[model samples]
Target: MISHSSTAHPMPNSVVNLYVYDQSIAGVAKMPLDDFATAFGVPKESINLNSPELRRYFLNHIQIITEAKPWQTHIESVRVINSNDPIVREYQELLLNFICTPVKRTSTRDFTFKYDAIIHQVITHKIMVNVVQDWQGGILGSQVQVGEIALNIPKGQYFPLVVKLQNGSWWKGFGSMVSLGMYHIAEGADHLLFLLVLLLPCMLVPNGQNWGAFASASFGIKHMVKLVTAFTLGHSITLFVGAFQWIRLPQQWVEVWIALSIMISSIHAYRPLFAKKEGWIALGFGFVHGMAFASILMDIRLSAGALAWSILGFNLGIECMQILLLTVVLPLILWLSKRSEYILFRKVVSAISFLIACFWMLERIFFFKQL
Candidate 1:
């Protein structure tokens, strides 16, 4: 993952996610009592927009900012998110304990039920009126910058993204993440190298110590399809499940396995490792690669609907690129495999992959020390 902090140049990624859920009802977001003492009317002294107390009041008063669709329901159960990080776990625990329990407040109005939770309702998105500041520290656009974007993001943690959903669109957010997924997959040299090395031998068979004549076009196409299919199936399973938080695997372990898979597959090109069962190897190792793919999703927590869209968009982007690359490269490999010199070429390619994969494994081991 590229950290926004490590480089001097800022690579700003506007990614806002659903982490905290407000547990309340009636769609009436509470304002700080100090700002407006009356529920129905604004007070005289608190009428000043410059007042610090009124500022906090208005910040909470921005309601239903998200343009909600008619079909979308807000009936989700308000529960704490599960996390291994102590800060996040404790934050969830505290939020749940504070918000879930009912609170009965006596009201003069003919209201039957009291407010259970002080916080706002849990939903897909929150609306906020943008609060910008003036050059002289006066509020502009009635907005405030909530958090600082310090350059250094700690490893093994998500880089902090501070975005105000003042006027942001849903599809735009989805598109940004999809673009990110495409970029990551495109830059994965080890993964591409692994695929390349494994692909070369698919068109040839073993003749004594060297590769035999090229397989028929049908055989080669079928062979490549099988490997690709198995790989896709294996990775997609882990990618979807991991993204949805069904199972969690240590990233370091997954990267280690990915590098190992590449090296082993490279050797298999020289001399068969799994023979006709190479699909099984692809399937197994593809799980590791998929887990690596799932890492981006682990960082940003989105509402269920948004998350579904994200998964669909990102996978579409990844698979499309993968297919495009294969479409262009496979024919060239098929052409080369027809020549007598292809066996040596295959050997040379595999050798390069083997060395690169070894280096990747070492790099993965010392991950904490790297950018």
Candidate 2:
């Protein structure tokens, strides 16, 4: 039976006593009480083995110590023999095993392997950490995480990564830009419809003497090129300024204005609203499109040079797609114009465009809550 030391003084607030037992050793080889006392620099009389408080403190603070020969099969169990509380025991377990472990050295020979390993680990850990945070309501609640993971990565590194992943080459950025331009044209139904409506009037003029067709088609292409160019320049300027200066506009207001611009453009198509100064209308409206484009660039958070490259890439893509569409649609427009049902088709297209624009305007302005 364990005997209590009556002469034991109360343990100091800053000091904690613990027992490290080597379980692998046979009988009598367990922690020698004299050595434990000597190692801890405490008097033999201070050890109250039977005292529950002292026993708990010891259990929570200390881990069982063991030794094994190199390459020998050994089972080493680390037991927190005493602690102030259960939390202390857990803290000791975590600190002793994980926190106190030495960091592995990175060798020059295995730099690439280690670098990839580290990257994989970081990405995996980030994903897992986010998942855990979400589970704990740390992510899904009021807090939002932001900022780049690699603050040290150079702008040069960033451009290469963007180009490598996107275009497969830095110089082939133009090809990527063209592809993006085509995608934007194909995806932008409203923009395409607006152009289509403008094409309608061109389809009505009689064959050979189709002055309206020739003029409108040529003017439409010129206007589109000018308008898109103005838009690209305007947005590129603003995108760089806004991104670097950290200028942000209310997203809702921006979206509302964009929808409004489209609605107005659609209305112009219904009648000769912008008639003689159609290019001016396109140019003016293109400014609004510029802001929309800037918002896209801003979302990307690219560096100034890369952002410039992206602007070129994106605009080129838009231009290439527009040109392709015009090429394909021009002959179709010419052929359709000669047909008896051309006017009917034109009116129908214009009406659908107008209705869609109106719907968008309403959705953007009033259905803000739904979005």
Task: TM-score each candidate.
Answer: 0.58, 0.47
Which residue runs of candidate 2 sit more than 4 Å off their true CA positions? 1-181, 202-248, 338-340, 368-371
252-336 per-residue lDDT for model 2 (tens digits): 6766666666666555554556555555655555555555555654543333664566667766666566667778887786667
lDDT values, one for every candidate: 0.55, 0.41
Off by over 4 Å in 1: 1-166, 207-210, 368-371
Cα RMSD for candidates in order: 14.9, 22.0
lDDT accuracy of residue 204 in candidate 2: 33
Best by lDDT: 1
